[model samples]
Target: MMENVVIRTVSRLAVPFIQIFALYVIVHGASGAGGGFQGGVVFAASFILMIIAFGTANVRRRIDNRGIMWLSVIGITIYAGIGFLALLMAGNFLEYAAIEAVLGIPHLHGILIDLVEAGIGIAVMAAMVSIIYDISGNGEESS
Candidate 1:
């Protein structure tokens, strides 16, 4: 899939903007249609660009499978932890209001939620890239 020139070029060109947009989406999720899942996939596209451009070896060197796995786990943990914290505060799971209370600024609830979504995005991107790299066999294994 990454072999196509069009895919490679588009992915490369769109990488940065996609990432930025992803952040925007995650942050504005409460007010908009985007969220953690959408942003994470967008974030992962950057790495996908790297893999397509330089091959799997380069991507692997920059981000190994083990590291990606840990990252994914950590991301999930963070998301869950945040939800738990909200629950502990007597709010529904993942309730941004609880987070706002903790931060002492109710208005910042959206910001905090966005942060968590970003984390999830990071994790998803890592996991997806890792899977793609693994399947790609780290590029042509130099002679």
Candidate 2:
């Protein structure tokens, strides 16, 4: 999927909208039955599309490897941070009740979980897309 996006420049135009929609899905996962993992994959698809349309060099110009790496790290850190916070408050990792108390929204456990999952998804997707872009040699030669 990433490869196809990178090779097709047309996808670039649609990437932004796709990413936004993915975020919406992630945020509303609790109500709509979607989650972070799904949204993250969708978000990553945007970068893959950019890479497909533009090539590594072009993509790199837009977003350097270092930046992508940092983003990946930050994403994972956010996931872990949330889990750690939950553990501190609830005595269990990723326990949303603890988070709810902290945030003063004790009734939105599902929504909170969805937000966390979305963070995870974004991170995973970005990392995966970066990896794919790094490995893919270049856009396929035009016929």
Return the top candidate by lDDT: 1
Look at candidate 2 and give me any clashing residue pairs: 5-52, 6-51, 6-52, 6-53, 7-52, 9-53, 36-117, 36-118, 40-121
Compared with the true structure, what per-residue lDDT tens digits does model 1 show for residues 18-56? 778878877776677988888777777777777777677
Query: In model 1, which runs have C-alpha deviations exceeding 4 angstroms?
Result: 1-14, 99-104, 138-143
What is the lDDT for 136 in model 1?
72
- Cα lDDT tens digits, model 2, 1-143, are 44674446567568879989888878877777777788888887777777667656777777676777777788788788878988988648988877788778657677657657766885887778776765775554211
For each predicted model, how many residue pairs clash, with residues at least 3 apart or on different chains?
1, 9
- Taken over the whole model, the C-alpha lDDT of each candidate is 0.75, 0.74
TM-score, structure 1 vs. true: 0.75
Which 10-residue window in model 2 sums to the lowest lDDT?
134-143
Candidate 2: lDDT of 97? 79
Candidate 1 achieves a global lDDT of 0.75
**Where's the lowest-lDDT run of ten residues in candidate 1?**
134-143
- Model 2: CA > 4 A from native: 1-9, 102-105, 108-111, 138-143
